[model samples]
Structure formats: C-alpha cells, structure tokens
Target: EAATATATAAAGDDGGGAWRVVGGDASADGGESPTRGDASRLSRAVDVWSLGCVLYGVLDADEHPYGSWFEREVNVINGKRNLDRIKHLPEAHALITALIEEAPTARPSAVEALEHPFFWPDARRLQFIQEVSDRLDKITVDNPMLDSLEGRSSAVFGHRGWQVVLKPSLLEDAGKHRYYRPHSVRDLLRLIRNKRHHYRELAKPLQLELGDNAGAFYRYFAHPSRFPGLLMAVYAFATEYLAHEPLFAGYLGPETARRYAADAKERCASAGASEEDMLAAEEAARAAALLSGDTLQETRREWFPREDAWGDAARFSVSSAAAAREAAGALGSAAGLPPVGGPAGAAAA
Candidate 1:
C-alpha cells in the first residue's frame, strides 16, 4: 500500500494517517483504502471526497482549509469538514456542501458536478432559449403603425406572411458568449428533445398560428441529424467558457494561446469547416482567454486517460457485454466464420 500508514506511536490510534506513509506496530491494512465511520473499503464516494478536498485547495489558493494532515484526521473522526471556508464562490457553496456531505450516498457524481449550475447559469440560459424559440412563430411583424417603406414585407423566416423562417435562421444574440454558453449538455439536450416532437407535428399547421420562427425551429430539428446550429452553439459556448473560466483563465499567455488557437483552427478545418469559420472561432476563444488575469501557469487536470488525451467531452451510455456478443456473433455469421466449438475447424482450414 503506497499511501497506507498507521499511527501506532500514539495510544488509542489505529491504522490511519496515510501521509505518514508507514504502518505501525499492532496495525494491519494501514490506510491504503478509505474508511468512513465503521465502514471501510475502496469506493468512488471516497474519491469524490478527495476530489472535494483537492478542489477546496485549488480554489482556495492552494491552501488546505483543514489546518494540518493530523487535523484532518480529527475532523473525519468527528464527521465534520470546513467546507464553508470557500466563500469566494457563493454560487458554489451549495455544491461544496454537497460534495463534502457526511453521508456517502448523498454525494453527487463527477458528471453532476460538471453539470452543476455553479459552473454556469444553466437554468437561466435554457429559459432564455425557450422564450426566444417560442417567439419565432409570432410572425416577424412590420409595425403596421409605421409607414410602408417599400414593396418588402417583414416576415423574417420566409418571403410571405406565411413564412417567418429565415433561410440561414440567424440568431439574435449568438455573439454573447457569456450569456449563451451551456454549462450542462444534459440539460440543453433535454430541453431540445422535450420540445422537438410536439413542435414537429404542429409546425406547418401551427405556423398559421405560431408563425415562421416556430416553423424554422421545427424544420431544422425535425430531421435525424438533429439541429446543428444548437449543437454548435452549445459546443462553442463550452469552448468560450473554458477559455475564460477562473481556473483556466489567463493561464495561456498570448503566444501559447495563439499556438493553441492555430491548432484548434487546423482541427476545425479538418472537421470540414471553411477557413473563415475556423478563424472566427479561434479568434473568439483567444480573446476570451485574454480577458482574465495574466502570468501563465498550468491548470489542474484529471488523472489517467483524460490526462494523456482530451477529456471525454461526449457523454454516452455504456454498452453491455450481451450487446457486444450479439453484435459480434451477427458479424461473424455474415463473414462466414467458423461457429463456436468447431474443434478449431481443422478440415475447413
């Protein structure tokens, strides 16, 4: 056990305090695994607690609020933590409380933490999206009170009173990265899916009532490919937010930011983006990064594969073993492969 140790030197003490990194007399198992109260074992809950502690340090100027290593042991034994000390982020206080909650079952998962409102204003943004999306069907009005300037009519999405849907449905506030970024993809996707089916069936007939904006939304998202504009908007929002987030902000100096920006532009171009769109996104990201503090320093990173490669940004459900086996079996039959238990198929070979 690399981090296991016992405090046998102290009377009434058992296997704990791994920072000591040495087991003591009359101690076994050390503290290599985690324990809470009477229960002791390896667990993701234990890791979540550790993550909370590490985050507590990162957000608090690398200072451990638990005093010393020995002090933390005392706190754990008493089932208490100093989570309230992270006052700089009032929006995150509830999150910090939840992370260090004494009950193991009460703790939230990593994905939950990433999706939490503490990181971004998810509810507000979603509400804003819904409000504007609903208004798209109101039929772009020309303010009948005003004088007619020319033969042109004001239905935005289409040419006539029946058509409000624009050709390239231009969003009103797309450039405002601060207001539009989505902290939670799950939340955004949920809102989009929830609205898609109802609006799809009602789009044409309802465009008579709702107008062209609703028609535009329905037409764009009704397909199997889903709405690329909304998807790209969410992706762009994340990129902009991450670039300017307090933890990562200003960590990339201009030169390094430029290099990263160029790398991103190249990647975007490879992903079938026009050179112009690529440059636009790159510039936006770079500008966002520069808006924060200076003095470049490395930002924190998660361990393992995420450390070596890009973090798994796209969430997906896990595949089951049975599903894998069934698929493989079907593929083998199509390929005319030997069946299982065929004695290595010597004659066929």
Candidate 2:
C-alpha cells in the first residue's frame, strides 16, 4: 500500500483546483503481486483506464457514459460494462480494455497501448493526431478592440480608416520563463494606420446595414465591454464556420460570415442601410480587428485561440462534436479524431 499511500497523499485535498496531473496510481488492490517494473506497468494500465474514462467525460463535457464514476467502476469490475457508449470511443477502447485486464500479468503495457491501432488510427487520424500533438507551434489570437477616437481620430485616420493594438501584458504566458515584449500604443496605432486601407473594405457593408447595432460591435472590440451579446454572436458564428480559413483567424468574423449569411442579407434589405454603410461597418470591424491588440493577445492565448467578444481563448476549446464533424465535412477531413459531438444539430447553422 506504499504506492497507494503516496498517491493518496499526492492527490491532496479532493477539492478541485486549477492544476491537476492526471496519472496512474500504484498500491491499489492491497499491493499484491509483481516486481517494481511489473507493478509500474500495471499501475500505468490502471491510469490508462482512468484516462479513458476521463477522456470520455471531457469528450462528453463531464457526462459519464455509465452514469457516474463509482457506478461505472463497479459495473466495469463486475464485467457488466462496455466502452462503446462513448460517442466516438474509437477502436482504442479494445486496446485499453486489454491493458486494464483484471490479472496484472494479462494487462498490456503502456508501450503496447501506445502502439495500438486505436492510438495510431489510419493515415488521416495519424496526420491529425500528429498535428495536434505538434500544435505547440500553432498560434491562435483573440482580442478586444479599444475605444475608437470617435470622430476625432476619425479625422486623423479617416471616416472608415482606423488602427488598433493590444497591451503587451496579455501576451505573457505563466507557463513560460521568458517574457514577451509588450506592444506600445504608438506601435499599435501605427500598425492600424498602415493596415487601415485593407480593413475599411471589410467594414463598409456592416456600417451601412445594421447602423446602430453595428456601433456596439466596434465599441465592444475597442474595450472590453460588460455587454457583449451581439459581439459574441458574431464571434461564435465566425469561429465555427471560418476558424480554418487562413485570412480570418485573428480577424473577427465578417458580418457576412454568419452561418446564415442570407439572414444578414435579409436584415440589410429590411433595414435599408445603403450597401456603402454596411460595407463601412463590416470593413471597420475587420480592419480594426486585423490591427487589434487582442488579436495578438489571443494569438498567444491558445492553440486555436480566437478572440470572442467575451475575451476568452482556448486551444482544443470544447465544441459540439457534431459541429466539428460538420466543420470536417466542410473542410474535407476531421482535424483530428471526430471531436466528441454535442447534441444532434449541434453544429448546424
């Protein structure tokens, strides 16, 4: 029970905390049989089984396929459980089951689990897994826009022309020892000035169509706003539909990027904002977004970081598994394993 005691001590308080290292536990089942090497391997197999369970939980957003952990473990030990309940359990469940065999000697080693077809999959899954495994180099940026100079800076820049930059502290990573150089206000504004032409084109249409509804979007971007409903709508739709699109990563979704772009066309037709104004707002958001500081902040924030109106970013952010599949359908291949899908029609427009 020494390993069990150590693991129990290592578990510390059961109160969930910000950091946790999900790993294997030794010394369970009364520390019976096997040498240190065999015990370590057996311990890892238990950890893998636990991980398979946790992976299912996370994939299901905390829902357990067998109802509860206690119940699931009981059922599993009773030989009354099957792993197929996990939405996309993959064939790896078989390999994991083999690893978790009741008899210590029967359990597969971690090395064996790693080599299983479930882990390796076919070429596509292999490519995606390798990409995700190597995603440390991928950059996703999210940002909030700063308050515009109103009409004053507008005169300095242009009616539609604008610039944006992020504060540098946002780029700092607690995990990294090296510090990031913060961008100066001058650097941000200047970049905005230089990129203004490119962005104004995107804002033009939105500025015209939604009129006042459009102002809220820009205001939210300029500074973090307490109210971000409209902006969130825009960000969600865009990220879902366009995250993979190269030009649009850091840039907020174009007003036209909505899952139902036609709905926007209808809105514009009803509002009667001239095409010019709509174009102005859309381009303004895009241009400023391109030049926005939050973009850089978000870029540093996640593996797939994209600034939402709420200002949160994440890599491997939780998403509707079905939506991921639809996205895969749209993109021609699932980025990795079919993400655990949310409820049906979860990713639909």
Candidate 3:
C-alpha cells in the first residue's frame, strides 16, 4: 500500500488528500513559475517571506496571510497577501510588504529588515534626524542634495516650512543663533546643525538653555502620527544628502531619491554651466538692487527692463526697524487685534 501511494504521488495524483505538499513550481494567474531546477529561487529571500507571513499572522489574530489553507499556496505563489487587517499599522504593514515582495531579489536582507523604522525607538529617530542635519551642514548650496532635501521637507512639512510648525519659543531661540536664517527648511537645518556642532563647547549655562529650548522641538517628534511624513522625510533626506543607503527605504521607497537625482542631472544637462552662471548673476543683481533701495518703480524699470513695474508699491528697504513694525502690524491685523501700542492692545494685555 505504501509503495502504491508513493507511486501515485510521484505521478501527480494527490488522491484528494487535504495535506498534500504543493510544489514550488505552482503557477498562479496564468503566470509561469520558476522551473524546479532553478536554484536561484532557493534563497534567504524565502526565509524573509516566511518571516513576513509569520509576522502578519501574529499581528492579525494568528490568521494566515494568504487566506484559507486550500488557497494559501496559490496565493503565496502569486504574491497575493491579505494585509487588510493590519494595514492600519503603517510601520508594520510597510515592513511586511517589503519582506514579502514578489521579486525575491527585491526583499531586504534580515539585517536590513531589523533596521526598519518600525523597530526604531523615538530617541533613535531623533538621533537619526540630528545626524542627518549635521551631514547636511557640510553640503554646499550648489549640491543637488540640498534641493532634494528642500523638496522632500516641503512635501512632508508643507511650503509654510518647518519654522511655522515649530513652537514660537523655539523659533525665537533659534533666531538668536549666529547662523540663524528663517527663510527655508535648509536654513532651519543649518541653524540646528551649527548649534549642535558647538553645543559641547558652549558654557554649561548656555547648554542648559539650549536644551530647555529644544524640549518642545523634541516633543514635536514624539507623536509622529501627528506629522505623518516627519520621519520618512528625514530618512529620505538622509538617504539622498548623506550618500547613505536608505534605512527606511522600504517605507518610502528608494525610487523617489533616484528620481530626484535623475531630475537634477537632467536639469543640469539641459541648463548647462553657462546658463546656471547667468541665472545666479541675475539673482545676485536683484538682491543687490533690493538692498540698495534701487527697486523703486523707476529704478526697477531701469535696472530690470524686462521686469514688471512695482505699480505704486512701497519702497523696498532693508531697515530692521521698518521690517519689525511691518511684521508686527501684519500679525496684529490678522489676529483682529489693534497695534501693539494702541489703547485696545493695552487693555487686552
């Protein structure tokens, strides 16, 4: 009887048994599977897939990832996993998805899998951000890496930028730094980079002040869900700017960084070195004109003949006091409050 059964199995006859072994070369969705002799299919990636299935089962009430037993083998072969139940858990979902990628070569190694953001602590995440910021400080403005960082930061944090998202007190403290500039995300990162670089060299009193002020900054990252893109953006920024392999590439994917690099290269090729120099010269000229109070209606037309007229706009000035008053007035107006020195403001105070 045993010899007869073995011969029947070898002849592809399961006899309707519920526990029959499914061959690895099972096809699904009319797609061809790897031949039985293909040794490339047998790899650590198989273990990664198994690990993913186990994790999915553990997270989803011990249920099989591919479905019922009868369909499980087919679904696994087709790379059709039912992750609906655990989809709400972004980090876990991401890790599992990468682990079970259809292409065996696409799956992360065991060590890379362990480094996923899903496994990171809040402290480590913060440290990661600090390290990236430090690395970015060494990059020049002309580097495409800064452009990539700026683009990603804008997408994650918004065009209003990181300054607006941070606490008012923290912003104020940042302004006091020698390298302070509130114009862009690059400026904010540079400020942090400079402060952090000299932090240990500072006096104890200054160090404590810096730490106390940065408490809210740290708290900002404590609840990442509130800022969904914060960690991913930082990770992407690091991957591109620091020339480091992505730690959370499985989450955000490495395609974005590659696309940015490609786009940057294309733009440079199309613009050529002479065009870039000309553009830079024009920008410097505009800045010089604005600072020299030469952007008045008549002067602007004279200096930048192709540019539009200021059209009765107020004269542009670099006067600090005037800029402060203008900013204060704008804030007061937006809040429906009177100017700072007015009777209504005094009474409200």
| lDDT tens digits by residue: candidate 3, 81-155 | 678787556568778888777665567777767767778765566556666665444334554556766766554
lDDT of each: 0.36, 0.34, 0.50
Which candidate should be chosen as best, given TM-score against the real structure? Answer: 3
lDDT of 1: 0.36
- Ranking the candidates on lDDT from highest down gives 3, 1, 2
User: In order, how many clashes per candidate?
Assistant: 5, 42, 0
Flag regions of model 1 displaced more than 4 Å.
Answer: 1-42, 121-349
- List candidate 2 stretches off by more than 4 Å: 1-38, 87-89, 121-349
How would you order the candidates by TM-score, starting with the best?
3, 1, 2
Q: Across residues 103-175, which tens digit of lDDT does each residue of candidate 2 receive?
A: 4445545554554445432332323222221221111121111111121232232233222232222222211
- Tens-digit per-residue lDDT, 1-349, candidate 1: 1012111211123535442211112223444433353233224545565666666666775455444565655555455556556643534555666665565556666665664445644334343344323322121123111111111122111133211222222212222222221332232333343444344444354334323454455434322233323422332322232222222223323332332354444443343332343243344333323322221111112111232121111111114323322332343444464332232222212
Instruction: Kindly provide the TM-score of model 3 when superposed on the true structure, using C-alpha atoms.
Output: 0.46
